[model samples]
Target: MTENTVESVRRALDLLRELNRQRVSSVRHLHHATGLPKPTIVRMLDTFAALGYVVNDRRQGGYQVTSLVRSLSAGFHGDPLVVEAARPWAIAFTRKFQWPVAVAVLDRDAVAVRFSTIPDSPVSPFHVTINNRLKLMSRALGRAYIAFCPPNERNLLLRMLAMSDDPEDEAARDRDAALTLLAMVRRAGFADRSATVEPKSSSTIAVPVMLGRKVLATVGVTYFTSAIPKAEAIARYVPLLKEMAKNIQTSVVLLEQGGAPNDGAH
Candidate 1:
């Protein structure tokens, strides 16, 4: 170990990260998520509570980060410009369709959900997925972002994926098949989750947000597989999602220019 390294600090940060992944986390959930021992979690949570960065409310089902944690984000943007522009449109899409929508931005080897409308959606497939990370090959949001990104960036991401140990990303090892799949996504104008992955009862359809040739982020909606045929869902939802992406793109430009969204979008 390095002389300057502190194992306790690293573990505490890891625990904090797991806590931030969902709205609230039970000790069991924290144990499963971080693989940290129960005693360690208790110690850390108690320490965090003492420090005013966390609260343990039995009525809330578990421990949750307190607003004081915001102090840690003094200079952290958390994809603010993109997420700020996307929030209303994503919520609007969920309101109209009654299905949950999520916005993801590339985060190194995978895509991370920055915003989700599961709370706004009456028919949310999952109870919570905020801050979830999805693999680049088998997830609709990840595929959408990777498929539409510029070639140089795509190649670099593919190389990185090829080296990943995550089973969902194994397709990258078969370079031809992976590229072919991405080509199909490009041709179809959207991406769908692999049928073989978990939660086979539901699916996601995703489209990229692009400015010129560069993709800024990906957006997707999750729906029950039995509620509608895939083709019909694609026909109906893809257009709206594409339009949402366009509105988000425009909003990004306006936000960057010190203006608000034009108020013309749903």
Candidate 2:
């Protein structure tokens, strides 16, 4: 390939990496994240969509990488590094507490569940999976992430949240309320969501998994509201949840340093 072709290929790979990181992004978001021109982002997105590696999301008005991109890792047997790091701890936490757990990372303006133990939890009341996206200001996982992330990242996320298409995620548009909520979360060192964002019978508590000053993800435990009172749940599980988060973070660091084996299945 010519020099120009090599440069184009590198740019395309960079765009793909940004898309994977953000999950769904508009041309503007891609430009901001990758420092590429808007026209280049648009052209690359159009090409990716035509190639069936990306899709236009009408509901959110953004471009999302499609399952076709998984072919790039066809021989990979494990989850993403972070998810691989959390899988064992998540399962162990569920088995010990008899409550379902989920680990999520920021995907654009939402928290996307990268790992969930709901389906495997022996005591989980709901057999269904918990892989759905959570609104940034309304769910415990998202609130934990937004509250503990670095200030600049938090501000950027808040701006993106404010542009949410869902009317129910109005908390994002309410800057004052969102800030107040985040302040409360910071002070509490964790976040909770009740029937307001979830079913009336269920609730969740979440803590951030930190790597230095950055929040790698948020880990959460869910239980039936009637089965466990909020205060009791907090008293019983918060410390354990925080410890698990630390362990997951340590494992991720170890994996990064090549000091541990990655044995978990994706």
Candidate 3:
């Protein structure tokens, strides 16, 4: 990448970090907070605005962070509110189902694991890292997300799949299958089980985290088929996973609707 690109990324991150600390700021306030040049700060604000991460108040000449930024960092930001919101529900689901539970959000071509209560299991071969890609169409969590996304986004993803490469023509062959998986997940109110993405594992049951109709993330419990039958896993986990997802969605909505609590800081 070019120096400008690198600098741009740094500047953008600095701006966001500052906003997270202060809650709200104007271009001048950002400059003071970041110690970046005035022109640079303005450019960063403009870019953030364009991406819908920052909302500008023309009248006050200030800017405030928007939920879209949290959405963009849904898997990685580790926002206290998000963690506080998801952990209790995730833990409860894990405890009740007696299985490992994880929450993930889409990040470009991959799905990033945000949090997990998955205990080390010798029987299960799959391993997931926080904030890392895990294929776009493979896992139950990934498919659950795609299933709940808007038609425009879903179609765009499908179009990309049609044009993409797959050594086994896996993408092409599974196009319909992927769509089917999504449909069933929606119809059943949750993803039953999947091992198609990470072979050797018995299955993963997933539910989508919807924010105002947008699929913000997926939360699921994974278990080894050898340890438990796929049918049994699904039968045991889907309802609980669905409940946790609803709780998480409610928290996200609350965070968005609530005013800035850290007002003076930012």
Candidate 4:
């Protein structure tokens, strides 16, 4: 496609994202937010709706997002490196902890979960989904990645997220919390997420997958709050979590060495 065609598609997608942020928005409001012509905005919305990517409210004269975006997400989640690098940790972590485990990567300001394994848990509820982006500030794994990311890159990620057209103050707070957690991780060598799901029954522990000083991704274990008591969660798993972090680091180093010559270390 021509450059103009690509740019048009991008702008249309941006319009859709903006509509999603407003909960619902009218064509005139979209024209105001995006500076696109009202007729063009209406046409794009109609096209998007026909494709099941968006839905309109006749009463409100507004539109909202649908599940079609997730169909696109399925392709991105299938990337080889993301799959190859994360799947082993997912399997190994679940086997060891008897809890849910996930491997995730930072996608701009979002956390993209490539895969997750849910353990049988009678006590705690499972809420996370594969291919879903977690709230960057609220999730332990996302925070761990942000905490260990190199200073410049981390700062850039934060700034870009802050200035995004779909800016989220909650996401910024999460980044701050992640920074705080990173500092604690540096000193203590592991990160924990307690009472994240229910006041009584869910928690998590996360570790960064580092390549030298850079953070490549994160691995985490989650449990129903009741399945593992708070004290036991830390006592039994923290050390093993650290071990997994070390192994991930070593693996990164090996992968770097095995890459085509002159590919700079991550």
Q: Which candidate's TM-score is highest?
A: 1
Q: Model 2: clashing residue pairs?
A: none
User: Cα RMSD for candidate 3?
Assistant: 14.9
The residue pairs found clashing in candidate 3 are 22-265, 22-266, 202-225
lDDT computed for candidate 4: 0.67
What stretches of model 1 exceed 4 Å from their correct place? Answer: 1-77, 259-266
Off by over 4 Å in 3: 1-84, 119-128, 166-169, 172-178, 192-197, 259-266
CA lDDT of each prediction against the hidden true structure? 0.89, 0.83, 0.68, 0.67
lDDT (10s digit) by residue, model 4, range 171-239: 554666646655776676656653343334567777777766877777777766555686788787777
Write candidate 3's Cα lDDT for 1-266 as tens digits. Answer: 55546776877897786764433467777788789998988888888889888888867447877878768666765444555678778777656656677778777655677776653222323433455555556677777777788978877776766666853225534667767766766788776434444456457777888877788778878777778787776777776677788888777766777745445644
lDDT of 2 by residue, 1-266 (tens): 55556777789998987776543567887888789999988899899999999999879559878889989878866456888889999999888888989999877888888777875566564533435688778788988999999989988988887887886568878888888889999998889873465477888899999999999889999898888899999998888899999999989988898764564632
Q: Clashes in model 4: which pairs?
A: 137-174, 201-225, 202-225
* RMSD versus native structure for model 1: 4.7
Worst 10 residues of 2 by lDDT: 122-131
lDDT of 2 at 29: 74
Tens digits of per-residue lDDT, candidate 1, 47-150, equal 99999999999997899888898898767675758887899999998888998899999989899998888766766536457678998899999999999999
How many steric overlaps does candidate 1 have?
0
lDDT of 1: 0.89
What is the Cα-based TM-score of model 3?
0.59
Candidate 4 residue runs with Cα over 4 Å from true position: 1-77, 80-82, 119-128, 161-182, 194-200, 255-266
TM-score of each: 0.72, 0.67, 0.59, 0.57
Best-to-worst lDDT order: 1, 2, 3, 4
